[model samples]
Target: MNTDTARAAILAQIRARQGRPAAQHAMEVADVEVDIGRHVRGPQPALGDRADRIARFTAQAQALQTRVARVASAQDVPAAVAAYLHEQALPLNGVAWDTLAAHPWAEAGLTLEYRPPRDEDKLGLTGCFCAVAETGSLVLASSPATPSSTHLLPETHIAIVPASRIVPALEDAYALLRAELGELPRALSTVSGPSRTGDIEQTIVLGAHGPYRVHVVIVDAD
Candidate 1:
């Protein structure tokens, strides 16, 4: 069954257990819309101006061991990514989101498969829906064209972020999502630096559950 259908069924079961009839789908949807419209935001930290936010994001990301790079325009992304890979002595083979297929990867001498990542794929490339400056996290909305596996399954993940898409806080990211997407996608992922786990003897180990390295290439002009 589809996600919506499965969700409705689960809710129906819960209602039945509570000795109440299942609510109409339309009514439920309308109620959710109203609640969202009336939602109140909690107080947030000051993020200064746009330039300040970008600087803060860069600092925070660096602290988390995420490499950040700035490019003048979208056309410069390939070269920046290529440079990073070369510096790290990594292979130039990878997978990328289908939406990013138009970028000149070939010209940069990078071989990228425009599909979901495989077990052996060492690198993955993607674009963020928006970036949260407060936490230095990238917000990724999953769809058919932009699979989450592209970031999750690879050893290295390179994200191309548009400078204009960076937001002050996590709340702003969600607000932008609601304003633009109207509804949530299949999955929403927020990544901050490389995935690490200190579960074994409290020693941090990167790539425990995801990419060992997270690289951000910020494009000044989208």
Candidate 2:
């Protein structure tokens, strides 16, 4: 069936299951909205101060085998990324999200294409939608400017996160998303570290599916 027909069928099934008349549909939707607005989160452990949050995030990230770095501001992001690439002996060429195209990449002596990463691309840079300090995960939302390929196809992935955007818990990340976007994006990708699996012989191997190396650059939002 066509997209509209499929959607109509799904809605019809849902309405039928609800057993509410057509006249109550509006009221049901309104009630759902109210419940969403009044959503009470479950109890969570206190994460202490902001400094503690940063420390916890760094610790968790490192424990997950992810390298983390801190920069004073956005202007320092290029230099930080460059330094990481140089330290790792990787090429200074890669694809990056358009949101970061305005940065001074040339000043850092790097070549970054502001587009989606191609199959041959080995490095990619992206700005995250938010981060979870509790789990040290970078939350990425796919959009026209920020494609999923930038984080998935590359062998080396570099993410720039604003310190202020780091929430205390994973739930807080979703709350921030809802408050800002009013709706979820087409794709929400969360990367705690480089991809790995031990399904074979119970031996760990990184980059089995995605990037072999995941580096994070935390920029001071202030």
Candidate 3:
């Protein structure tokens, strides 16, 4: 076939598919939240099962948020964090500068200090400004509680997120802040999970540059 004809045929095929209904985008893994008083068993077997599928999947996502855990207030963050570190079996060797919010993170191993970045410390355990339950995103702002480098320099990042901070939807995260926090500052980042990509060969790989293991200890304050 001539070059022009071949190009025309390709364009026609593309246009035909463009008119068709496209598949929905992949759902973000975060943003699962549930009030204390709520109950739903297995899916009810019914004819309109596609809706059932969405419900079932959503329930499972909701369960994950519940399982993630929670803590009372920011002050309790440190204690809960100590438990997490003990469970994870991480040595308290490194000491990277982190934002110390009100949450009580149990820091049994880590010696809390204000230190400059050096070759010794690899772990930059920190807390975020707010948690987005919709995407399981950790929102960090430029403040004394959180430093920008902690997110990047850490080999293993452990973020302590409380349930109260978990908003119902992605947009709700911003709404809560807009009312409570006036005139937000620069550099607001939403981190979903550990840094990962499958660009090379469609094989998923974690820890490209960010933390290899991102264990979000979701604390239930209630």
Candidate 4:
């Protein structure tokens, strides 16, 4: 039955329950009722009310930016990025990478085979679609331009972030997307923290279904 019709019928029955005859009839277990007048429901809150919360978060996140460790800068990203890979015990090459601009790893003192998306990659590094400053989220999207495997299959992943792309919160990122694209696009992901699980007797473990660690390299003067 339509929800509005059912609601109207239930309200009418409640209003007349005391005055009308009480009749007992067999009923199915699936049918149930809700008292709507006592309940509150709606779409959600608007953006203006959420403004202060996101702004405060931006301040907190900018504070953390001062404490980023092991940061080494380069003119171009590949060389510095390669150094990060070597530090993490990853191979110099033979790791598949896909990004906004996938370049050759030769200049970084690394040599890796660039395989198709369907093949496996020991490590994957992709340029982030967006990075939310407040929650430290990295957004990714899957498309013909960005294959899904470049995100999911890799054991260790790196997010090559541009300083300009950092927003305060998930909402800010969404707003930017809406402004740039003129509507919400498909396959938006807000990845905060890392992939971890409290399985096997509640012991905390990393690297279950996704990458064990997400190394974010923020390129300066982006």
Ranking the candidates on lDDT from highest down gives 1, 2, 4, 3
Candidate number of the best TM-score? 1
Alpha-carbon runs more than 4 Å astray in model 1: 1-36
User: How accurate locally, in lDDT, is each candidate?
Assistant: 0.93, 0.90, 0.56, 0.58
TM-score of each: 0.85, 0.84, 0.58, 0.62
**lDDT tens digits, residue span 1-222, model 2:** 999988878887787788955344677889989998886788886898778888888888989898999998899989999999999999999999999999999999999899888889999999999888888899999999999989999999999988888889988998898999988999999998999999999999999989999999998765
Q: Identify the leading candidate in terms of lDDT.
A: 1
Error of 2 at 207 (Å): 0.9
How would you order the candidates by TM-score, starting with the best?
A: 1, 2, 4, 3
What TM-score does candidate 3 get on C-alpha atoms? Answer: 0.58
Off by over 4 Å in 3: 1-67, 71-79, 96-107, 115-119
Question: For model 2, which pairs clash?
Answer: none
Tens digits of per-residue lDDT for model 1 on 1-222?
999999999999999998888876688789989988885788988988878888988988898899999999989999999999999999999999998888999999999989898788999999999999988999999999999999999999999999899999998998899999998889999999999999999999999999999999999885
Query: Please, what are the lDDT tens digits per residue for candidate 4 over residues 1-222?
Result: 999988878866875776743332234212322343223334533323333433433444344331122233434667766776777777665444444345546767765544444445566666667777656567776555555566566766666666667665566676677677665446666555446678889987777777666666666554
Give the lowest summed-lDDT range of ten residues in model 2.
20-29
For residue 143, what is the lDDT in candidate 1?
94
Summing lDDT over every window of 10 consecutive residues in candidate 3, give the lowest-scoring window: 28-37
